[model samples]
Target: MKKLAVIAVLILLAMPSNGLFNFHRKAIHFNVSHEKYVPPFLFWRWNERNVVIEYFDIVRNNDSIAANITAYLAIPPSLPNQEIMDIEFEPEPDKILEDEYGQKVACYKLKLAPNESLEIGWRIQAKIYNIRYILLPFLVGDYIPPDIKEKYTRDGEMYKIHDPYIQQIVRSIAANETNLLIKAIKLHDYVIRHLSYALDNKWDDAPTVLKRGNGSCSEYCFAYIALCRAAGIPAKYKGGTYLAELPPYNDSIFHRMVLIYLPNYGWIPVDMTFDEWIFHHYAFGFHSNRFFALMTGGGASQYLNWTYNSHYESVAKLDIDSTARWLEWK
Candidate 1:
């Protein structure tokens, strides 16, 4: 395992292409380098009660022959407003690992016999807080700290940070603009005005959305990330299920949001589409009274793959839901 890890690192270092790489994609750009900045100490605070995430997965083997499968479950981290105090998993995760995206994840590998059913449970105990707008850093370092640089600043396949077209747009937006915060705000504004929110089932690369001028949450996130990266800013994404208790469409649904690194304040949430839809009243720097993060970063989750697999659909099924029934919101 150590040897494999070493080889992977070496491959990354030796690869001719510049910027973040998506193992699943086969595109690369040359001369890609990352940049950084600092933001003002502007922020607000909110509070959260009992916030919890749970998953009930049932796998059935309808095939005439037995089969084996591997799956992973995201273990919510203690982030911004959500603070996890406990975790419970039946037949507990086989083991956990820091995935390619740099987020810690729990994995479960199982085998089922023909005509058999396998059940799994995952739960978390936690409280949520509201620190919507990020403020000056509690921990400060050089312009863009290594910790932040490693995860958020780097590019991903979806971000397409090195795409020539994306680089041009970001450069045009930041022209003669030296202030980091202002640049980010400007980019946010640009995205709001440029793209119309049209839901797309598949994730689109940043350049594609920018050209098409319309896309859903993933598109918004991808476009924002591309712009940030082009301007030498650190950016990243978070995927989870947010309480769809708001206007327009009010039904439980899965969602995605972006986070950009600002000196001093660190990573700040940017829900561009949601913010604009509400005319920037809520969201943007912060979103939601309740958000259940299933995973973050740009990559695929093994568990998600299981659900997307056509073969698996005929043989198994997955069920997941999160709520805050334990905590008193009133």
Candidate 2:
């Protein structure tokens, strides 16, 4: 009897749950919406690598007077595409505060004597993920959240979205385009074709770029973003240092790009300058992990976009020198 019972138990364990001992076993069926569908083949296609960024600023009191300096250093934030693994400061900031955009601002206050200098900076270790979303133009829905549109499309300091000239340009370029993705691409191409790459000392704004017909990388980004926003496409600024292994490192050399929000794909990077310069052909709707993105939104300050913010009050002349550079960390 015992032997027969053991054999029965073994048979029960070996049998499929639905075949013999089925108890509350239910079949599961996943109904994925087309808007949020990710193909199985592309689901796991993500590459990750680490990079290090060193941003430093030097404040020198040149005149025969003392000065009080308040420096607000921008610390890179963790985003969906990149993660801050670790951070180290040269001599630790006096205090750290979070800006409205969730970017960390390290505040340093110092009293520098005449001919004295102060250097403040931070080294950030970040892991950047190269995850390219295969965007199907037909699959991109045209619905943006009301709040997103309200926040991104509104007129800001440099982004003159509601300006008459900007509206006219938007109408001419993307007015007839129904697909949001297609409209964005048209605007990107228009900026690339309309503007010439030239470094200017004047104000960097959308209308100025359109009128002058020449601007640097930041101008290209501004022009494209303004057009997109005017056409009711939510877009924002992305500022960072391009990580390249050539010509050494210089603090003054940084890059700017634009990120437009797609209904299904979220934020997609659009690099018109890169496309124009042939650094990355067909760069729209695609972004590589070759740069360190420091800031995502703009218009928080009058003279600063996505970089560090500094304010100093002194009775003497102050000369501030800043440098930002990055390299891949092994």
Candidate 3:
């Protein structure tokens, strides 16, 4: 058990994301260009070292009859620069699921005797870094294939795609521009300039965020997503653990970014809140791989989709301790 704030409420909200990028590539379709990724000149710089994560949930049953509990948590997959190692869990999850978005999940179906307190934890080591993307501008088009766009672009209860305000904003951002990448960069810049960072007043949605002009990472990311979808770009949210909260974000680890599909690129990462860092050459891809991506989608988490039952109390949390990075979190 770490501190009170760091490792509690692991169960998280999901979100949506992107389109037009900020690059100067001419307008083009998905099939118009080949893969344009080139290794960055600086092969490697910072290694955030290894982050030990312990995800645990405490479930207390106060009822007389046996209490049934269903719990699920998101586990990140190991990617090229990002590696996952030494995974462990107690009372092993009843089952593991590979969600539609390809997230690896651990699930537990349990029966808690009356007055029993059940705790389950999953621990792992994450080798993290700043994931870099090719800096050269790539072609981003105005249209995305219907089959592809609908999956990420749909207006959900949180996205508020039907909002007239959001619709107008997206249109103004596009302004007859067909380059999806440029549009994305414009949206990124819009959020950076418009919204001042602050704790959310309520469940932050795009319209709400736009109206306030200040929000958490989720709010900024959601506002960006809403604008992208409205502009016909397929986008979705990326939820993760920021290795260490810096400057505007504070000590909170729960963080959010966006992933917009570019014409040639499969799905590139973007972080409106950290756009300045990218713009100033702080890191490539906006996401400094500094954060560990655990879940995606809207606030309705897919990680918890398998969890639901009668009266009970539950929360998800992670403990991240690191050195050299000067990071301390629970």
Q: How do all models score by TM-score?
A: 0.71, 0.79, 0.70
Over all chains combined, what TM-score does candidate 3 have? 0.70
Model 2 misses residue 157 by how many Å?
2.6
Error of 3 at 164 (Å): 0.6
Runs in model 3 deviating more than 4 A are 1-48, 61-66, 113-116, 138-147, 200-202, 245-253, 276-284, 298-330
TM-score of model 2 relative to the true fold?
Answer: 0.79
Q: Order the candidates by lDDT, highest first — what do you get?
A: 2, 1, 3
Residue 35 miss distance in model 1 (angstroms): 17
Off by over 4 Å in 1: 1-42, 60-65, 100-102, 114-117, 134-142, 245-252, 298-330
Clashing residue pairs for model 2: 251-324
lDDT score of residue 43 within candidate 1: 44
What local lDDT score does residue 74 receive in model 2, on the 0 to 100 scale? 70
Q: Higher TM-score: candidate 1 or 3?
A: 1
Give the C-alpha miss distance for residue 233 in model 3, angstroms.
1.9
Q: In candidate 1, residue 320 scores what lDDT?
A: 31
lDDT of 3 by residue, 98-200 (tens): 6655666677777777667766756667776544444334333334556667687777666787799988887787768666766666666677778877874
Clashes of each: 3, 1, 24
